[model samples]
Target: METSDNATAAEETTPEPERTGIAAQDWATASAVPQYRAAVVDLLGALAYGELAAFERLADDAKLAPSLEDKAELAKMASAEFHHFERLRDRLAQIDAEPTAAMEPFAKALDDFHHQTAPSDWLEGLVKAYVGDSIASDFYREVANHLDSDTRSLVLSVLDDTGHGNFAVEKVRAAIEADPRVGGRLALWARRLMGEALSQAQRVVAERDALSTMLVGGVDGVAAGFDLAAVGEMFTRITKAHTKRMAALGLAA
Candidate 1:
């Protein structure tokens, strides 16, 4: 099992043209086929912009914090997101794709999601941090299995929460403990977040042929692509994870 640092080192050792060309072509052909390359760029682009948006959203959320300590904590998470965005942007350039161009297709869909589900208060913001972010992370993790090694490692690295989710869980649980009534509202809010996320995801897949095909490409030994049964199971897995996390915070899924 190569660590992320080890994988990054491996990625760096390749010479320039080959690194950006044959190596990529060989990896894509052997794994996802050449056409999957577009999907890879789309994936990386979406992730990069998502992290940048998260940084901005978290910074905005920090301003609504009740105390300096809380503000500082959110600020730290925001900073981490910015760093992740930088990594994804660099990865885009390494692949000879324009970062802005790759990310452009996803901007409207993501922006719409954020706008429609904008957090109404501190609790809502915290819930979005956990529920919304985790949904995106889970979807990416599913896609990562079909990616080449370097991209897989980069995706995994960027998705790491660095205990930010735990912090949200702790704060949310404590609030629920203090006032049981808050849990009901948050639960509803969480459901809304999930709905909006799924809606946007469906929209993306419907509009983006490459990304949709990649998901259904059945790469990595998936014999049937993402067929109905497979997609159903995927949703089940995501729901299970969401439920488990919510339970950990003493909230209903």
Candidate 2:
């Protein structure tokens, strides 16, 4: 009877392995380090919510589509965004975190970004999908590099551009070809998107201590943190990438 009791007690006492997509050893290492764990949770939370919001926005954009084909494409993209969100949500759960709670902190900032940059037309939606999302993806990639290998891989994978790239580029470029003046208008709109994105991003950094620290705190001591010089250089690289993306769309930066 005592042996039976001991066996059951042992089973109860042994901790369950975490269910995150990353390796168990990696999860253990991240959990052992306070800053690393907090940063990872904060980053994943923000990204998961971002994808969920993107899914909704893309679905809304589908309603404004000019044709059945375009609406179908938008719906497909929205579905992909939801898949990404599911992956992130599962990853969060594996770590015993509440997916909705993790997502709550970022809701306002991301919603504000979309609200402030609401597209005026189908063309604007396409451009915003490509340009605005690309910038956000670039920033996420930059931060992912600072994470552990498994976590970094998961982050990059979820950040995948999906299947809308060539579609947006081709459509926007064709529109520019049809009306040269549209390029000028889009260029201005793109600039506004960039500006608003930067504003909201700065606000996010200012408000989220763990995330902002992750930017400058050097998670796991793997990459440079956010100092003034570092921040300036970061924006410089983002600007260069933005310019290239605009050029691809046949618009001025």
Best by TM-score: 2
Question: After aligning candidate 2 to the native by TM-score, how far in Å is the CA of 117 from where it should be?
Answer: 0.7
Model 1, 1-253: lDDT tens digits are 0012211222245343322222233444543454567778888898898999999999999988989999999898899899999999998998789999999999999999999999889989988878888878777776665566677778888987645677787888899999999999999999899889877777776676666666754443323343656656766666766776677667787
Clashes of 1: 0
Query: Any residue pairs clashing in model 1, and if so which?
Result: none
lDDT by residue for model 2 over 52-116, one digit each (tens)?
Answer: 98899889989989899999988988998999899999999998889888888889999989999
Candidate 2, TM-score vs. the true structure?
A: 0.86
Model 1 lDDT, full chain set? 0.75
Mark the regions of model 2 whose C-alpha exceeds 4 Å error after superposition.
1-25, 221-226
Give per-candidate clash totals. Answer: 0, 2
Residue 111, model 1: lDDT of 96
Q: lDDT (0-100) at residue 159 of candidate 1? A: 83
TM-score of each: 0.84, 0.86
Please report how far candidate 2 places residue 82 from its true position, in Å.
Answer: 0.2
